[model samples]
Target: MDVAGAPRRFTGQYYEQGRDIFTDVDQNTFKAVGEEPVSTFSIDVDTASYGFVRASLNRNVLPTPDAVRTEEMVNYFRYKYPAPASREQPFSTTVNVFPSPWTEGRKLVRVGIKGYELPSASLPRANLVFLIDTSGSMNAPNKLPLVKQSMLMLLGRLDADDHVAIVTYAGNAGTALPPTPVREKARIAAVIETLGAGGSTAGAEGIRQAYELAAQNLDPDGVNRVILATDGDFNVGITNSEELKGYVEREREKGVLLSVLGFGMGNYNDALMQTLAQNGNGNAAYIDTINEARKTLLDEATSTLFPIAKDVKIQVEFNPATVAEYRLIGYETRMLKREDFENDKVDAGDVGSGQAVTALYEIVPVGGPRAFGERRYGTRITEAARGNDTEYGFVKIRYKRLDSPTSRLLSTPIDRTKEVASFDSAPRDARFATAVASFAELLRGGRYTGSMTYDDVLKILGKTRGDDAFGYRSEFDQLVRRAKTASSMARLGS
Candidate 1:
């Protein structure tokens, strides 16, 4: 119904982009400590990948490997890392090194950071622009309807002083509701109900319009953000993710940020959503069901809406004397040049209040089993200074205060002091995070996870699934079960 260079519009039933888009992820490879001693990357807290993977498994199908980002999947689960003492530091960093669960002769290092939570009474006012995509592609029950419910759930977390406006894009962008205080919540809900889906997607135009409106009422004293809720199918003008990425970057300079809430499938543009959110000084979440909506918007409101730190970067230096080789388990897309860590001009990920981030590295100790194969000429290994023998590596983290232009530094040594003798003896949260990383790797065809199967993941889940009051872990247990079933079905050609 549409030509090559022409935009798609609704016909009798629907004329939507009928395929999902995901950026293919090439798993990180092992690096010889002597060859590349420092590993640097940005912190990521987006949980969209896990929810999308679960949605796929719920339909009894394996998710496309490209859609499974191990970092996002692992970061989705909560971890009880120690919080910071005060807002001055904003967050606390903790480390634990334990034996690997899947592979022998390799150590798994856990780097954990927990942001300090702000009390409800101490939180600032909020100005939010609800940039809804009411394109024809959103006609499904899971798209526009779920988006309306999500906005209402998020609204419950806002203070009475907070203001909200609605902007929508279909054939073109328009302002659906002017900025209004939460005191007129009923009126806002009425406007949300009136939204209907049709026309070609005007995603890029909607972003421009939303940013303009957010600037007119930008709340410098509080949070100013444009929340884009869509299936991520940008079919009309300015559809390229790279172009949109630049616009969002420029818009972020004016103090109005962007966060994306992705909905639906078959037409999801995850790659574009990720580019916009990453450059917009914000995070992304996927809403598959009402429970997930409650979890992301209601339970995690404090963290999701208020950022305490921005442009967060992490650099870890592996000591050749102690560590022979190392590989970051996930974060394939977030890898940054080592020089980028110290450059304040380079934008990075942001951290929110009470949010926890976890990263794992698989390391081979000096003279241990090397994945890159043994060196030629049989060179002597114990040749480094004795003083540095105790430390495996040094971790340096740089983050900017939410309102500050300059960055601050936090560093610590990942030494034997942080190591536990046995994997079971490690901190429960660390062990649980390791399980998540292992499960994620296995889902992506287990290229690095040797011989590890679903049963192995289940065993790890059974032990490390700590006080799961929200039942998220229990839900994960069910998902793993479904994945096993799906895998069996696929193998049987059913």
Candidate 2:
């Protein structure tokens, strides 16, 4: 879809196979239309916008799906570093950025991969098994072959003592290599090169073997995970969701985590990947190309592998006296019941070392002139609550030690007047979060107030464009202009 009169290049470089997938839509605009005007095409994912270009083929060819999801795309955005929690010899810094939201007809959206620092002291010895899909379906350049290259990039990030393993699935799953030290790069590289497509996918068996290796080589005080690289189409044995989920759950009890790293497109099963990741006590990501593999493995390696906090659940109790209604943005799927917060069995999000997660709630005033109508009328408040009618809500965080069951609680209050005006007035990190929320609102049709249009979003982003440190904020400004122009042209065409 053309947003601007023509597509304009942003901060990041674009790549294509023989430049066949991309086409000039208008002036500076370009879209990936595929060979022979087909629907599907090879794609490279990045930290921005999931590196996906959606469009149609001109003739009879079916357009292939781009596997990247925007959630992971937004997560890939660069973040400004913050002061480490410890002060005595701990790292700390203050970051500030200038606002650069969209303007006139341009649209800018800011998504943050929030500032996270990996302290050498807190780094863990890792045991990682890369379970790859070598089925015929992975013949696409963006599939199995790309998986090998991506794993190679990740291999470079491993320390000498770290253990790496390899497993493959097709007609059957087997250990391509046992857990080996990272220093043995030559052997690892050789195994990767030997992989090729042939049989049907046996994802379940592959996972089972991978977990067994991880358990045998488990790093009790370190990161132990199986990184499954696939197109997410699990055929063969244990293909059904219930059985697959059950397997992961049982293995997780053995303290072996799973990181579902999806590759390629066509028949991409987002639901399956999401389910496995959530159940496996890990995160799921889609890699559209090699560069994305670098970002996930190199730049954000710590967050993807090691968990600083586990089962981290957030509970905010709204004060009936101070607030009428509140709706959390973006985390609808992450929400927990009031009782679930106290239940240790229920799983929640994991926060990596130095990783910062920000959540926002847009609330309507209670008993005020600007209320969004009554949601509750003189209803008796539940006994399972905590508040003294002094603020909007109590923000409570519950987390567990990576291996422990008992949880810890951290509570903070939302003082009413300490409102963050525009993106500029907030901390660099908070501003970044504001941009993400704004963008998500726009994408979801802005169900709540402040679902600003593309122009408005750009305005917010432009004003908060912090130091072009990672060039992420700068790229956002460019996206704004492109979006504005495309939106306008679309309107005129209609």
Candidate 3:
């Protein structure tokens, strides 16, 4: 245990700050469009980073730069993009380019993808295993109790066709409730309410048992998932990340997906949870409040439970004649090698029903200020090779159906025709998403957010705050105010 008196796994070293376990990779750097014209990365739908940042700001502390993944922050909110017309494609992509709000002479390109939405009555039956961590570390109100309430919210959304099981891990792993139909809500709630937190965390053991239960009660034509709710402190058994990941990988091959629901703040192993969820071909979400829980499990139940596309990847080829330098705004960790984009065996991110994923890129058009210094020697595009003045880049997406081995391809050309004259003239969703991305960059040290301040972000957000049906945008406004106050306090302390 650290100074906070919270129970933590006995790792090699004991840091006084128990929250030191949170980990993230370095950010992406600008790439010259002349040298590397193609940008490829897997689509990510995880919303944990945004929730984690919100949790930190709510506590009056600034989140670490690593904790702020700008892409995840932007994708957390639902955008009003049109869904695909048919399940044959599963998703539709929309691209828009507008003047960059942060950089003076550059342009911001937004790529949006919306997965097909299935009616609630049309959703397939589900076999869900709740892997709850009842270790001593989860003794707080924000951990075990919150998890119970969140599970209850999910239970309310499930129907008679769904089957539920509960497994808890402490010093040992055991089944709290056997595979029971959703119609037995009273019995399920009873089992959940009886759960109490204590003992060490055998997360790996719990996972193995949950997978066994999930496989035993598998739904051949429906969703089979293990939802692990924990603070991500795994110890007592199979503590090595590689070993745990290997176990998850093997289980995922049997058609049992895994999604992680993170709770608590101190000692949260975000990196491990992300790795497990990614390897298991599922999504990860951080549950900070009951409202967030409802948003994840109830409001977005179809998307949260039913995946429409798997291993989705986007590769954009920028025309060197139109753009001189480019950099993907976020998704540093989701970057894929050019070769991996064509390799179907390579695992990527998944898109669920009605889920919308977005990616942004900052580009310096030819004759504009280059992100990096000019290349001493490079092949120049001639007038003929430059193609027409209307085209900007080609966007290609590859994804495999949930049950297919081969991947299908979709392509579209982004052109000057789609470019809006100014940021203010852009679509409301695009403008608001850009503001969110800018705010995220500001929170992550603002190295690239030139001349952009908190007030500037607030103003942009205020203008673009459309009809927020669920009040998510309003919550974002409150977070911005909190961040402003937090920044002021930090400056004073410094």
TM-score of each: 0.94, 0.75, 0.95
lDDT for position 256 in model 1: 89
**What lDDT tens digits, residue by residue, belong to model 2 across residues 389-419?**
5455555666686657888765556554444
Candidate 1: Cα lDDT at 31: 95
Cα lDDT of model 3 by residue, 365-445, tens digit? 888877787767976876854765477788999999988988999998889888999889999999999989999999888
Runs with alpha carbons beyond 4 Å of true place in candidate 3: 1-17, 382-385, 488-494
The residue pairs in collision within model 3 are none
> Which residue segments of model 1 deviate by more than 4 Å?
1-18, 377-385, 489-494
Worst 10-residue lDDT window for candidate 1 reads 1-10
Q: How would you encode candidate 1's per-residue C-alpha lDDT over 1-494 as one tens digit per residue? A: 22112343334322233366666557899999877889999999899999899888888887877678999988999888888999998879999999887778889999998888988788888999999999998999999999999999988778889999999999899999999999889999999989999998988899999998889998889999999999888877787666788899999988988999999987787777888899998889999999999999999988898998999999999888889899998898899999999999999999888999999999999877888887775434445534689999999999999878899999999999999888889988887787778878877889888888888888988998879999999989888888888875551112
Q: Could you give the candidate ranking by lDDT, starting with the highest?
A: 3, 1, 2
C-alpha-based local distance difference test score of model 3: 0.88
Q: Name the lDDT value of residue 166 in candidate 2.
A: 97
TM-score (C-alpha) between model 1 and the true structure: 0.94
Best by lDDT: 3
Greater TM-score among 2 and 3 belongs to 3
In angstroms, the error of model 2 at 451 is: 6.2
**lDDT (Cα, 0-100) at 395 in candidate 3:** 94
